[model samples]
Target: MEHNHDNIKLTSAEVSYLWNTYLGDSLSICVFKYFLEHVEDKEIKTITTHALDLSQQHIETIQSIFLNEGIQIPQGFTEQDVNLKSKRLFTDVFYLKYIKNMTKGGLATYGRLLQNIYRHDIRSFFSKCLTSTIELDTEVVRLLLEKGIAACPPTIPYPQKIEFVHKQSFFLEGLGRRDALTGAEVANLHSNIETNQLGTSLAIAFSQVAQSNKVRKFILRGNDIASKHIKVFSSYLEMNSLPVPMSFDQEVTESTESPFSDKLMLFHFGLMIYAGIGNYGVAISESRKSDLVVDYTRLTAEILKLSEDFANIIVANEWLEQPPLSANRKDLTKG
Candidate 1:
């Protein structure tokens, strides 16, 4: 229970961000509990239990840090914000997808914080967070496989050249088909699934949380893109009888304004898009003789482009958080 306030400098915004994350962790505990009790799948239930335990531990750790600093705790969303008793309109598969997506958000947030914060105590907390979130992500994938819902994208051999949309006509006029299968195609499909999940979650969250007409319209476009990708992936998954990740849960509201700031919403979108491109790229490199890689590559390109557009919106709204860098004139640098 040692308090070390002397070493680290924290801004109000940083403090607020930590507090929000803490609250989110707390809420996730409750959300996971709901899933554990309601979900019929045993593997998913175990994953939820493990995630809940980690989130509970994180909440305690953050609370202890706040207490040490003598900072008043800010209230977070409560059961009041969630309608637990509401009838189940969406499948547990969608709930699991949402859980997976939320962990990605947590990973991005804490990973960035770990790189930026100078304080030993705070950095240590974020380090734990990053590790825990990664574990949760693994568990999620495990559950997906156990439930027979995991999508297996086809792979391709390396000797055969794979054609990508970008490499082809700018308007997607000509595409070639390969005969042999390769492992890289599976990687690409896996990556597409990950990114598609993120986009789907963002659309659902925005439909439920946003209050602005303009913002909702933007979110709607995002939803369209995500839905289209999900359909394509679902078709592939269905061929193997792999449970398709749920698309457009009725639980999410289709609204104009949101509870979160436009900046936060767009920032979250940007991070997911960034991750999406890398995930797809990995698949492209690992895919075999399958055409799935080509499809996902096209989707990745689209997501990257859309992500850049969203980034511009974030910048225009002054929502982008500037990273730490050295001044051109080092002598003038001051703490």
Candidate 2:
């Protein structure tokens, strides 16, 4: 099972991972290129360079795999998708935290990928991806701590002794006010808050530079959505006397000049929306209380709608790329 049998062709799952990874990395390249152009802090620049290098390498490797398999490459973002001459959109501090969030997400993505990826070479590729991303994550975290900007999760007092939940009301319904949050629940809440905080910053930045009216309005609405979600998530932590994660809206600049094409910006928003939806799904399972589950499910549905709107905008511009699809059985039968 460890060695890849060359005779074995790739399953749909394997192809899906590679195809999706290719698109994500390609988008990262465009964003990082714009970051590097205006990034001032030496420490932030160092990690940004490393991140850009990693994305470039990933694109090359994925290209090699697709060519070898006779699969057509996805038309992901390219140089034309970015405009280097545009003014800076984000601050140096934003760049540092952005990498931290990115690698954190990358670890989750590449780790989950290993479960479905069976080919030895493909598995090995993602394994290496996990390792490299961990290294980047460490570097970003260390820098954040050194700068004293680390938003460490709230610390709860240790229980004197292990106790079992004996009450049925532990799964609170309307408000989780009855019982204190579990460790897993707190982690999910803080993580989601942080993600929304970052997303709000992105929404503000994107809305400032987006050329199209539709794209601008979508991202502006996204800012309101993220801010609203942040407040909801924060209230839970507040009720528990845990400090809520801080927002990064100030980290964005006032520049209105577009650094990325409208297509790229919209695509990035879609990616963020999808990730938010995925996080909500995970939070639903991690949460023990019914109210928390209901909240996540409701929020996920709202974000899913936002994702659909982004898809529509992308499609309207003819900028959406098709993923690998199975054969049309109806067409085959018609012939």
Best candidate according to lDDT: 2
lDDT of 1 by residue, 177-234 (tens): 4332334433444446666765776677755665556556677777788778868766
- In candidate 1, where is summed lDDT lowest over 10 consecutive residues? 165-174
Model 1 error, position 325 (Å): 16
RMSD of each: 7.8, 1.7
Question: Residue 27, candidate 2: how far off, in angstroms?
Answer: 0.7
TM-score, per-candidate, Cα-based: 0.56, 0.96
lDDT of 2: 0.89
lDDT of 1: 0.63
Kindly give the number of clashing pairs for every candidate. Answer: 29, 0
Best by TM-score: 2
Residue 330 in model 2: lDDT:
92
